[model samples]
Target chain A: MATRAPKTKRGTARRETLLRSAERVIGEKGFAAASIADITRDCGAALGTFYIYFTSKEDVFRELVGMMGSLTRRMMTEAVQDAPNRLEAERLGLRAFLAFVAERPSLYRIVEEARFVDPDAYRAYFTGFASAYATHLEKAVAKGDIRPGDAEVRAWALMGMAKSLGDRFVMAAEKPDLDRVTDEAFAMIRDGLAPGGAA
Target chain B: MATRAPKTKRGTARRETLLRSAERVIGEKGFAAASIADITRDCGAALGTFYIYFTSKEDVFRELVGMMGSLTRRMMTEAVQDAPNRLEAERLGLRAFLAFVAERPSLYRIVEEARFVDPDAYRAYFTGFASAYATHLEKAVAKGDIRPGDAEVRAWALMGMAKSLGDRFVMAAEKPDLDRVTDEAFAMIRDGLAPGGAA
Candidate 1:
């Protein structure tokens, strides 16, 4: 976590700017090469001012990773809220995730980098996501919105599919045909959730 | 590539030792924290002799990533060679991948670290794997063993699923249950490959 949260609206904006700068600097140069001075320089703040918000570079990085985790979950929930069934939610959620990656490439890079820089945060990010996702899968199964299967296994598999698709189509591709990617993935996911699917 | 492939049999053994040593050092300490001297020390090779085989640490690291990519493909192909059909191959492949990860955790770490240390090598590794996987998917579709679909898209999606499962079940879990993970993942893939599937 950050050392402290800003007490005023202006301070909040300043802190936010520093975070945005960290994303750009760290994402581009990577965690090893990125430094607090570089982050402050990019944000047009005095280097000493960084110590006012973040205790260290590691602190800001953990905060960034944590922030991304919350943002991802919230965005996904909002994206699927209008779906009438779990199958539809799967489609909407995959689409939302791909779109989110397109809009925020740094989020993908940061989470990945966290794997090396901050191991605990990295594990927490995915484990937390998989836990919630598994619960959702179990509920869908009980509601008959999907086939009965190993919720934990399916959650991890489904999440893996989305993460890989995002890496390929969104992060790597020049003109990401997200529609096609989602449709193909959704087709496979939808079948796996069908009643006759070997639950 | 290494600085040079040893022509003499004894020299070849020495080079292989250094390469293995590098994997241990890099995998344990990570790319940034790991030094070339530490790698040589592990292999009991003279620090200066390290350069006789590899120009630099980065060169050796890239070679290692490339080696892992080939080894992974070769191992997976061998694992599925006897499958009666595509469905059986999916089961065998996932099982093989998870088992390989459990046995060689370094492979997972190296490929992942390649993302930051050697981005191009990282891209090529997965891209190459996906291309070969897509070809296999296309052949299966043509043989009527699986439903027709976008082979490339499905290849990446399925690869992602296996990769994630490997990370969670094999890399992270204390004692991974490879059999159950394969069974659950295969069930989903089989259903998703059925004729009625969207393909």
Candidate 2:
């Protein structure tokens, strides 16, 4: 006879527990060094249990990427929707991104490691987010709020800048003032790329 | 007493051979995975001779970063100096950067792996290059050739963009149209940041 499945709530709780444990292990030991036994032991689960939820470490990594991406998108969407204008939306987006990275430095390492684990997965994760941001940028450009240009490229460039800045500042062992860096970066973007003279 | 230096140039040549061999091995198998025996064997040199010039595998990695940095700076300097105008200079600099990366994808991996091997070394390597580029950018900004802003931050942003672009195109196993991407990136920078739509 076939075995019964676990209750939905219990399965999700176990999954969340395992994911948290995996993140910590991967963060401390790196993706390559962290083993299934280590993650299961940390999560207080059995080795077989990990296989039930994640086929391998790579699956857990992909899930991490998806989870972070979804969280980031949700936060950014909320912030953008709250903004009254394009410039405000841009500022809000930058702040939200920095804030997210500052809160979860390990996530940065996970994302960085993903590039090596699977380039295709990395491209998919990045392109998905870039497309979402580009949609917002296109609206701003259409409204004459920002300069007319390739919104997709601009979105990627902006995201790249933010990621670089965060990697340098927020993820540093000795963190800097995120608020200051965010303001400085946003000012550069606004004054550097705005349609008119030095917005 | 310290052993007298070899009178013949053979010692220096042997050292160079070992360094190159180490680079190749590390490039293929990663720094952590590449054994000293593998490197020495690749060079057809005695394993003991490897220790004569370098303290350890990590020392070889240190030297690799320095070599790559100097090579990059030289190529970028030449490219920029040869260009007649700011836009041309930007294009030349980018083209140089991409070409250098395309020719040595292994060096790219080594530099990134340095973060895991030695964080301080990684910071020093990046700071050295960033400062060099920033100085060049500052000079251009002083002459009103480029946009008015924090030249250092702008330099970092530009470098970051190039790095992200390179990771996507040049370092991929399946290389993209690097020349076209370089041109497009330079064009975007010029048009997006030029003083008066001159680009």
Candidate 3:
């Protein structure tokens, strides 16, 4: 479904409000339990107002998943843009990822829920990220910034590590200590768990 | 809900049949959409027989999640039992996990569904695995079989890596090459992505 951008500033703000409210309601109550009425009510908007910007609850949920994808890519890119090498970039990228998860835990939950709610969207989100991630690793290899290996495999492995760490350290933690989690995890990422590695 | 084990040999066989059927049906249809009738139908059992073993659909689903946890731990333990070192165990454990996913893709989906269907069970599943895994890593560190690091961080990070790689290379692949995926990922796990490590 094509959810075109609103023309007017007020319409745009209202749409954003609906989207944020949907994120909260759907993320908290889940897609099945969450309703359009709940989403609209969360933002203090009339039930009819939800239809003006989106077609259905699925449409809005898909939009939220899409927003998560773009926001994550943007956040990661900006976080690692100025790193001197791929190794340092990995550190920065991971730290930024944990921070992002802490900041928008609901969005993370929403993206994961997409696996069941919208399988195609869920596949697209990870595949898109993995493809781009693999390409970056390829460039890093060509530049001699990292070891030579299967970029696709490396990308998936690293992504998994980051995702799991985010789940355990940020999402599950009552009081998250991102600094220590990142430090230890990033250390492993940089040097691995094998004996005789860097200090 | 206390679902006592059926005492008779025939009763035990029927319960197994129902659980296996539940795994296939619920895994395919998802927890919300799946019904006890569907599960019993898949196993060619009468509707009344389901209640003999299970209190409700939720009870059976929780049991499946619990089963996955124990089965996974047992499988990993057996897979890595003969490894000479912790690093080797990591490799063996990961390969076994992927193979397990391939063999029982439905069960894999069921455990993942637990994250949404039964949140406490989901936490228990991972937390249980991570705790055991961390202990193993601690032993390895003491023995100098692996580098010294935060065992908990290493455990979760490695688990995440294996999980993500399984999702992409095995779960998502049309014809999975478990050998190559295992090798590539295990290499990164052992030596890491740093430029000047093992060749």
Candidate 4:
């Protein structure tokens, strides 16, 4: 049993190391340019070891996409839950998204590139997040806190604004003021989707 | 002069053919993978002929970005002007954007990839369109037709929403009902930004 615990820990460590290597390669070279050789070399792992964990480069990319989606969703959900009201939830969601992009730009790049790598995977990843946000929007709409429409579409639009702004201004630019950008983006969302006329 | 006219016509024809070839090659092979040689070969042009018009592959890409930005902005401006009111202008802008993407999927792909190819070029290209839209939004805000705020930021959010939906759903998916999808997107924007809860 003691031996089994060490083996399992090593496997987990190996998986994480591979993921980090993949993120670095993808971020620098983009999804199309990133090759298995580059990833294996970065990880200082044999090709055989990489294959043992990931079926193929594409498989590794899909796993990366899934991992990023789950991590971002979890973080945003936790942040939203910590908020006191729907408005705060919305603001926190935007901030959490920016923080996620800032913290793991490589992971964020991989997730965005998944659109080109596999549109279905990209859709699946976004659909999960959209559904979660849609549920939140639906509740707010039910409470007459926000205008009613297609909550799913609204959620996507809201998320898209945050994602685009974060990618364009924060990730693409160096030395961006995160606090000001986040505040401006959050204010835009709040005013754009406020319960009634401009608050 | 009459003899020179045919030569000018041929030059224009060759340029158009080269642009079309670049679009196809870049669409299939991506910007980084699509070589000038591939583009020239596809266009049935000599190596020297390629440099006569463009200094480098990057030059062609820059021209393409400029062309697309101008085309999109022109279409959007026309649509907004054709609209009878501010609300209609918003709807028309959404429809115009969807229509442009639907008609030029390859161009859209090229423009999107430009973000990865050259950040400055990408910003310049998008900022052109953003500024144009912001002008329109500023007009509406000045007329007390829409809520007052930073028109530039509002324009970015609107464009971001349209782009995200276009890339995620319309262009990514085959045989998407563009009209319906566009209407759904516009509905959200209309509801979210409509003055005095008019939507």
Candidate 5:
């Protein structure tokens, strides 16, 4: 299922261009309706150019899911790099997530579409994210930045919150207030796990 | 697009069969790839019989989403019917949601597919749920069963957590512990909004 990675600089650019085309075409038209020709035409590349880099439409779609995972992780990392603690990181990270959704709504759609188009890729995307996110939470707890709890459950729960908020506030809203939504959602995240929570 | 509700007892049964077939076909192959013939063939009915109930494939798909929405709401209502308080209801509701996902993975897939296949239906599903869910939270806040917070945000956030948990712990799990997952998740939901959370 691995697409042939480009070797030369020009080849690398061609592959990236094709992947971008797939994201737009597949994301908009969906995996079943979107065709390789539509992706190639959008890429400004000949039909045969697609074959040189990827084996099939499914191949390119899988690559797109994988690429989206990497891109989202990089974006989240860069967005929260300077946070003083995990709690603050949670705030910055959520704001970053919502803002990213605003900027790359298609990426969000692509990852979701991967659930049907490529279930393995979809599972890997969230599972991998949850795994790493849980580790981050574990360390935060060890350092007393956050309260002790099951990081695995918290990781998935927090990811779910961000995703739902993005869908409701950003993807679905006409003009969403990113800061306000983040503040409201982060309020729950902070106090939800804060030590000595009242009954 | 609306499917014609059955007028007679036999018509109703036939329509139900078609809807079941549509769920199986569309959930497996997706909306674009799934055809009327595929649904009818799966239903063991002639192709022409499909139009007797559903206007088209799109009609039946829309009906399936509606049906799933009703079914989920019913399940959740039944699950939380006897809860002593909102806190207990939250625990029961989350567990019920995870169990529903496990029982009917196809329903989850169909609803998600609706997001792209029928944007209006997708919006209606979440928007309607969030609207009702917000009301529920508002009542709980008024009763002092939970801390005061933005009902709209909590509704979406809690829904997100349930959805994400269902995906990770039920739909994708090789073997999942419904009780343990529910307890861990309910813990966060409980403490996150608990009054007087420590800074």
Candidate 6:
């Protein structure tokens, strides 16, 4: 579906409203169950107004997934921008990621659901993230800020760790403690589970 | 959907065939797109015969998810049974998981799809596995087999690592090298990425 870019400020604001509403509705009801009418209704817009911004439900869902990808990348970048080193960056990045999941859980679930709703977009999201992550690891290795290993493997492994921790601690927890979870996971990431471990 | 257990040997065999077929059909086409007729057709069973064991497509999908949970637990247990220490068990277990993903990519996708199709089953499956994993970590900590940390957090983090690695290396890769992926990730899980890392 072809999504049109709004020309005027009002149109831009209206499109943003529809996108936000679509995120909430699609995130709650999922892609298959959520309807265009539901999205418009949720945003207090007429049914035809949805067509002004998006062509179909699939188009809006894909846009949401794309939005999530860029949002996550931007969040992580800003979160870790001031980290002193690669290891600190990992800690900062993981903490930021968990907090992001806690704050915008609807968008998180929507991105996950994209695995089935839009497989290509889903693959692109993670693949793009992983590639950028691998580059960072490579830089960290060159600087000797962290141990040398397979950057690609390490990047994916760390991403997995953060993703799982976010799901368990933030998404699934009754009372999420971002600080405690971040500290423990960061400890493991830095020193690992090796015997006579570093504190 | 209420699924009936097969009482006779022939009934059990037939049920198993239907289940195996369901795993493939659902895994390939996904739960929403896959139908009972496709499952029956794949298994060479009559349309009416599906009702012999499973009441509906949802029933069969749930059964497959359940089967994956038990099968994974069994596989992990057997894979790590002979490990001399917790660290070794981690390596063996990860290696086994990647191999399992490569062997049964269908069932792997099926379990993931369960997250949406049957939310309760999906939660139960991961919660059960994470609990068992946490227990193992507790034991390992008590034995001084690895450095002590939050068992639950570690369990989920490690599970996430293995899962993401499986997705990237085994599921997404056209040419997967389970041993190398296992080795690299195991190194991180063991010694971490601290400067002057122990390899």
**TM-score for each predicted model, relative to the true structure:** 0.95, 0.81, 0.99, 0.82, 0.91, 0.99
Cα misplacement distance, residue A126 of candidate 6 (Å): 0.4
Error of 1 at B63 (Å): 0.8
lDDT of each: 0.87, 0.74, 0.92, 0.75, 0.86, 0.92
- Clashes in model 6: which pairs? none
Per-residue lDDT of candidate 5, residues B1-199 (tens digit) = 5567778999999988988989989988888789999999997999999999989888888888988899989999999999988878889989999999888888898998898889899889989888988898788878877776788998999999999998888877899999989988887777652223442
Q: How does residue A137 of candidate 3 score in lDDT?
A: 96
State the DockQ of every prediction: 0.48, 0.25, 0.84, 0.28, 0.50, 0.83
What's candidate 3's DockQ score?
0.84
Which whole-number lDDT from 0 to 100 does residue B179 have in model 4?
Answer: 72
Local error of candidate 3 at residue A97 (angstroms):
0.7
Clashing pairs in 1: none
Candidate 6, residues B1-199, lDDT tens digits: the string is 6699999999999999999999999999999999999999998999988998998888888888999999999999999999999999999999999999999999999888887889999989999999999999999989988888999999999999999999899999999999999999998989889888465
Cα lDDT of model 3 by residue, B1-199, tens digit: 8776899999999999999999999889898889999999998999999999999999999999999999999999999999999999999999999999999888999888787889999999999999999999999999998888999999999989988988999889999999999999888888878889675
Off by over 4 Å in 4: A1-7, A35-52, A83-87, A173-179, A187-198, B1-7, B32-59, B83-87, B173-184, B190-199
Q: For candidate 3, write residues A1-199 as lDDT tens digits.
A: 8986799999999999999999999989889999999998898889999999999999999999999999999999999999999999999999999999999988999998898889999999999999999999999999999888999999999999999999999999999998899889888877778899675
True contacts kept of 4: 0.19
Interface C-alpha RMSD per candidate, 1 decimal: 5.5, 4.5, 1.0, 4.3, 4.5, 1.1
Give the winner by TM-score: 2 or 4.
Answer: 4
Off by over 4 Å in 2: A1-7, A35-52, A83-88, A131-145, A148-155, A173-175, A193-196, B1-8, B37-52, B82-89, B139-143, B173-179, B191-199
**Taking chain A by itself, what TM-score does each prediction score?**
0.94, 0.90, 0.98, 0.89, 0.93, 0.98
**TM-score, candidate number 5:** 0.91
For model 2 the local lDDT of residue A104 reads 76
Report how far off residue B191 is in candidate 4 (Å). Answer: 4.5
Alpha-carbon shift of residue B184 in model 3 (angstroms) = 0.3
Q: Residues A77-123, candidate 4: write the lDDT tens digits.
A: 78888776677787777777888888898988777777667667788
